[model samples]
Target: MVNRSQNVYIIAEAGVNHNGSLDLAKKLIDVAAEAGADAVKFQTFKADNLVRKNASKAEYQTRTTDASESQYAMIKKLELDEEDHQILIQHCDHRGIQFLSTPFDFDSVDLLVHKFNVKQLKISSGEITNAPLLLKAARSSKPIILSTGMSTLGEVEQALAVLAFGYTEPDSMPSIEAFHFAYCSVEGQQALRQNVVLLHCTTEYPAPFEDVNLRAMDTLATAFGLPVGFSDHTSGIAVPIAAVARGAVVIEKHFTLDRNLPGPDHKASLEPDELKDMVRSIRQVEAALGSPLKTPAPSELKNISVARKSLVAARTIREGEIFTTENLTVKRPGDGISPMYYWEWLGKTAEKNYEADEKVRR
Candidate 1:
């Protein structure tokens, strides 16, 4: 399990960018590990089981691939079988990075858990409504990261209810009131927190900045009392890096070997150098976000005396001269009385003589 509190768990989503070549897939793993990403994720699904032959492709998919081709045909060319899984897993072990795949069917789920031994399961946004898959994941009891895109809050609630109770049928389940009571209880909430994490996302590929609605991540965190993250589909690394600053415990972004590659997701994906820069920027942001307590930082403490102002004599004055606003002024080198006491210092007799541009004495 990822310790989200310590650092942002970064997953470079290399979905379908391998273009059905094992060599390309292994190269993707190498890129991810070199970029300092925590894991490299791929989509594990048999095209036949995932989509029907007649299913239409989304508009963005049509623009990226052949418009005449069906969704199944497009995805079929990208399927990775069991042998491919073994090769990729072994390569990930050698490269020192975690291997993750989003299972679209029950068999694929089992293959990943039983055969590949994936530590956790990442459920894609489209599968949030798939009851059988959700139940299978819940029974496995491995940590789950669920993405919510093209889904309403009620749909998210229903999915959480299924995971919390390990139930499939929504009609025969307990009432919403009872479900809330159980889910909010100490033990029940703890179990959910231990096993599940929610991710806020927009369903669009290369999602628009106006549609990002990053505040929704915090809303999910507050609503469920669970750790929340952002699965970014934006055009650049700025949004994901910004998500980290806004308290996303995990950040999943699509990446490719080259943006010019012919695929549905490559245009919106980050390249090798950009991926490394994203990781570096996220670490810098995390360090800059430091403590919550509002106090002077170590670097700024030394500057206080040099930058602040002190009460100084505006002109030369003799001993026992009365201090007044015309004779006293604020100046730098704040080793003397602070300007905050300027009002009180006025109308007081000076105990000692002071020269022009010198600090005023009480």
Candidate 2:
């Protein structure tokens, strides 16, 4: 979905780190672009649609924001209108970075896909079971990156079934049975292969390293035959870099101009400099991944003679003298008979006299 055909699609997620200021949001875009991210992402939603007035903030949100504030009140301050979305889209264009946003409601999805025309839709982990939203996203036909956190294999499969039904547009009405039928169909699987990318994520802010479960990422790739990526919520750059090394095809991590900035996600996000380091480190890991063949590298050829050992005369040996372990030994400068032939050379007559430490080039 993120054109993972090239390098891992690095998304510098600026999710609500802008503190609801359009200027701050623009600055975050600049930071992501400067850090060499493929895209900059923000959250798009109306507070009323996303949370109830009585809903309490999560434990981390309460710790980060006003403890007295309702979840709706906290998010209300951060809602970005359609006008703001357009400004961000324009800013991302100016900065030469792709724009992405997670849509929390159907209207937000329409605004992003139909109005601003973002290249893809980022579905957050909390929305994995939002079948209506997933179907709406697929009906739009823009590629989707669905995050799987706080979900099981069955739940993930169920979500994908909803997506498959929407992508295929089967004749029957949308229902659990229909979704399952579509998911089992060859045509539905093909549509999913072309339209969706799954991201393994830990939903908590500053997710615990132990909870990251990178092996589960491999499980995602095996269980679902689509490209898989990491939506990292860990404290630093290491987890994401390690994910790239372990075959993550895309990476999404949050960033903020300053971690001290008053926002729900800022404390867990990378500062400007750290974001750059993560991108640089991911690129380096990609280079290091290289080909899977177990062979010497191009740079290693010249060092073989210096580092590897070869058979050589341990002491002066006269011509016609029988070779033995005492008269022959392994030494460096491998431009001669390899040590692998030591057993064969034993008991064989020396073809010519050799000086001490001289390579036995037979």
Candidate 3:
């Protein structure tokens, strides 16, 4: 069970996939909670406040929707209002799961901090360069989780600098509340300061297997002295479970009601059933990662004799004959000399006659 006991905190990212429908959004929450996700996350943003009316969409965004529409226009249509927030929060309560959201604009962050009582503040990748947003988020003093996709080490370092020391006055440095990282590489962890958690991630939507580099998660923890995790963009549940095996403490993935839905994030997002499977798999893996001890476990101890081997006589040996490899071998029912004592038992005189397949005693 050494491999299965690690718990990966799974966050079901319901980013703008509700398609401006509160009913769909509530259903999404049900899906997340029912899937056993530790938390359900939504994107809190005002289209006009987050980006200029003329700002364009990312390439992936354009591919999913009409290329001519502005990113603001697309988001504005998909915006979740105050009423929606109230309902979603209450729905999360009813569903018995933590409610979380990533704020894209200053007002959205303030609203989440003051109105919803959100336990954790999530920083999306685009905001890594937005110093103003980072400062505001830091001031709220909530535990922060950062997405470092599309950022270089220097960019991450700069973001950390803004949070760690740059936000305070020139003469007074303030202590950050909490900092956590999620990325596609171990190199990203170098940009983090002390007390940070690094999560393995891939920037690509529905990230390719070759780009995962999951082993780098342990490398981050070992090299940077911090806890590690994963932010999966892979379309399936298998990668997240695999990541937990690599020692991920966090698991964040996009989730929506339907993959066939008409939204930029829907195609790569997990449907309700798939999200459930992902959570169940993660929990199962967590149960499996047990302790690291090599000794027999309490439960496994009873099977030791039945499963392990002990030294035994390969053939009948008359009393007073010296023990040799020709007459001694190893077999199960470990109640006699261990195979490790083979050398000591070799060339020794037997005190009594030994039958074939009988355990060898000192």
Best TM-score goes to which candidate? 2
Give per-residue lDDT, candidate 2, residue 296. Answer: 99
Estimate the TM-score of every prediction: 0.94, 0.98, 0.86
Q: Decide which is better by lDDT, 1 or 2.
A: 2
Whole-model lDDT, model 2 = 0.92
Ranking by TM-score: 2, 1, 3
Per-candidate Cα lDDT values, in order, are 0.88, 0.92, 0.78
lDDT of 3 by residue, 227-255 (tens): 66778898798898898887787889999
Q: How would you order the candidates by lDDT, starting with the best? A: 2, 1, 3
Query: Where in model 3 is the C-alpha error above 4 Å?
Result: 1-6, 166-200, 215-226
Residue-level lDDT of model 2, residues 107-208, one tens digit each, is 999999899887899999999999989999988888899999999989999999999999898345799998999999998999999989999999998899
lDDT score for residue 135 of model 1: 69
For residues 1-362, what per-residue lDDT tens digits would candidate 1 score against the true structure?
56766889999899899999999999999999999999999999988889999999999998899999999999999999999999999999999999988999988999999887799999999999886787677667678899999888888887787677552323445556645555556655676788888999998988999999999998899888889989999888999999999998899999999998988899889999999999999999988999999999999999999999899999997888888878989999988899999889888888888899998765
Error of 1 at 361 (Å): 3.5
Give lDDT: candidate 1, residue 175: 56
